[model samples]
Target: SLALGPSGAWSRCAPAAATRRRSDSDAVGRQAGMFPETMSVFGNRWAAALLVAAFLETTRFTDFQTQLGAPPSLLAERLQTFCAIGVLSSSPAERSGSERSTYLLTDKGRALFPVLVAALQWAQQWFRAPEGPAIALTHRGCGAGFTGELACDRCTELLAGAQISVVAR
Candidate 1:
């Protein structure tokens, strides 16, 4: 097994031999023994958009539909996928009875916040907007604008791609 060195910055784990894609595959690859890498849980672009909405506490079906302008079918599929993967929990909106269901992020889902934050940071840095970022997150305790920092979990130091090294199993 390839060790992550506590930082998990191993870009070399990318599916180097992956070629033209096919349909309905867990991953778009034929690389042998490609498991246990940085697999994208929500591979769909819309999935990320929906996850951002969920992080902001929007859980109702209608809310997701309205906010995302996604078709009912696609949205339903993604939501079901998230629930099936234990990333989101679905429950009745009403304790007694309700026609609608509500979605909540599970602990596993909440763990994706760091990944989301890092992606947002990268996007903000590269994709500049004329009016600045659409959202600016502030640290509650520190009271300062916050952005994700890529750090080494073992050494507790900031990381760059150049500082990372990947090993093959």
Candidate 2:
């Protein structure tokens, strides 16, 4: 079983793994995995919403607050974090002196498009939408409504969970 340790690291704490106490190095590794880190970022609703909104072309600080209903302080914090991590870039919205800045997703952030697409596909499959989808996307290239599919880069074959494997580098 996986559980969050008292120190805030996720530990595999069932069976034999639980019997042995974790060392400092192991504890550090627990927090270093990319999957956990990515989850940590996306798990914050404000952060996730901000990224999605950036993809949808919402750039201003005020627009993010209005769209996500995030408090000013919290929104600022999340935006700062994103900027620090190089996921988003901020620039003055105008040449004239103004406090406002436009936030745009950086190339690093744009690389996350596949993950976002997968998540949207999963949500559409599993979540109920009595009022229909809040947002429907259209593909400019295809000139039709967009539906994402995961595929292997080499073979271009459609992929599913069973077809994928996680291997450490």
* Most accurate candidate by lDDT: 1
What digit string (tens of lDDT, one per residue) describes model 2 on residues 1-169? 1111132111111111212132122232357566644654575545555676777787899987776666677677667767756688999887688979989989999998877767755765676355454445567777777778889999999998899998967
Cα lDDT computed for each candidate against the true fold: 0.65, 0.63
In angstroms, how far off is 42's CA in candidate 1? Answer: 3.2
Per-candidate Cα RMSD to the true structure, in Å, reads 10.3, 12.0
Instruction: Report the lDDT of model 2 for residue 164.
Output: 99
lDDT, model 1? 0.65
lDDT of 1 at 163: 94
